[model samples]
Target chain A: SQTIHQWPATLVQPVGSPLSLECTVEGTSNPNLYWYRQAAGRGLQLLFYSVGIGQISSEVPQNLSASRPQDRQFILSSKKLLLSDSGFYLCAWRTSGNTGELFFGEGSRLTVL
Target chain B: AQSVAQPEDQVNVAEGNPLTVKCTYSVSGNPYLFWYVQYPNRGLQFLLKYITGDNLVKGSYGFEAEFNKSQTSFHLKKPSALVSDSALYFCAVRDPRNKLSFGAGTTVTVRA
Candidate 1:
């Protein structure tokens, strides 16, 4: 079975502070990883996706960035956080050749003050 | 552009009644539709998907969705609603690159 893990579970950050959220997948290799953010009562916005290590495609231009340092490790980072950056950040993975069904992690809640 | 549209923002249903959450989509190529559920402050969970073959697809938690190509809709349905079924539901369309475009989401509230 494949499992996705995301951490910090929850965080409170001050404005202009750095942000780092990590996600990892176990029992699968070379899977597609994605980063999504959901604001209160809004749809999820795709932030970044990676096909392989060191390859990332950004969907929205914002105060966030993503990196695939390893085959199953993906990290979402920001040099300086903004108040608008506060939301529920989710990390999901999908099999390379499979359909669009995504396996998601528990998610990280970030409150930027 | 590939996109998904969940028309209702919220749906209220009584327990033991049939529940339906509407979803429609627009995509260039063959559409791959999917449904996901999200609890409060939790990540989305895959409920069902419609890739091909049967128009009626059964998925986790006794939930099902009917894909209508002519209507461009894939509506999630349940024979009997439960209080536990209250949550956020999302519709998605997959692009050729395997990226999923999600809808705004519909909140389902099953009253006891």
Candidate 2:
């Protein structure tokens, strides 16, 4: 079975601080990885998605960026955090096909102050 | 240009009663619909998906969704609602490139 792991489970960051959130999938190779953010009272928004290593498609233009260092390792990063950046970030993976089903990780809660 | 609409922001249902959360979608080509559940502070969980074949698709946790192509709607339904079912439900539509466009989400509150 494939499992997605994301950390740190929760984080408190100051304004203008750097941010880094890591996601890794075990038991699957060359999977499609995605980064989504859920704001208060809102649905999940796709931030970035990668079909392969070093290839990322960004959905929204924001302070956040994503990178796929390895086949199953994805990272979301920001050089400087903003108050609006605070939200629940989720990492998801799906098989490399047209299937729309995605498996999500536990999620990471970031509180920017 | 794929979009999903969850008309209701919140739904209140009594336990043991039948529950329904409405969802409608718009897509240029064939629509691929899906339902997901999110608990407080937790990630979204895939409940069901409607790719093809059966209009009535059954999924995790005894939840089911009916895909009405004529109506352009895929509504999530449960015969018996439980208190544990209280959470946020999201409707998503898949684009040609396989990217998912999500709706605003509907919060379901099952009262005891």
- Give TM per candidate: 0.98, 0.98
Which residue runs of candidate 1 sit more than 4 Å off their true CA positions? none
Which residue ranges in model 2 land beyond 4 Å of their true spot? none
Residues B1-112, model 1: lDDT tens digits: 8898999999999999999999999989889999999999889999999999999999999999999999999999999999999999999999887899899999999999
For model 1, residues A13-93, the per-residue Cα lDDT tens digits are 999999999999999999999999999956998999999999999998988999999999999999999999999999999
With candidate 1 superimposed using the best TM-score fit, by how many Å does residue A68's alpha carbon deviate from the native?
1.1
DockQ of each: 0.87, 0.82
* Candidate 1 chain B lDDT trough over 10 residues, lowest sum: B92-101
Question: Which candidate's DockQ is highest?
Answer: 1
- Work out the iRMS of candidate 1: 0.7
**Steric overlap count per candidate:** 0, 0
Q: Is the docking of candidate 2 incorrect, acceptable, medium or high quality?
A: high
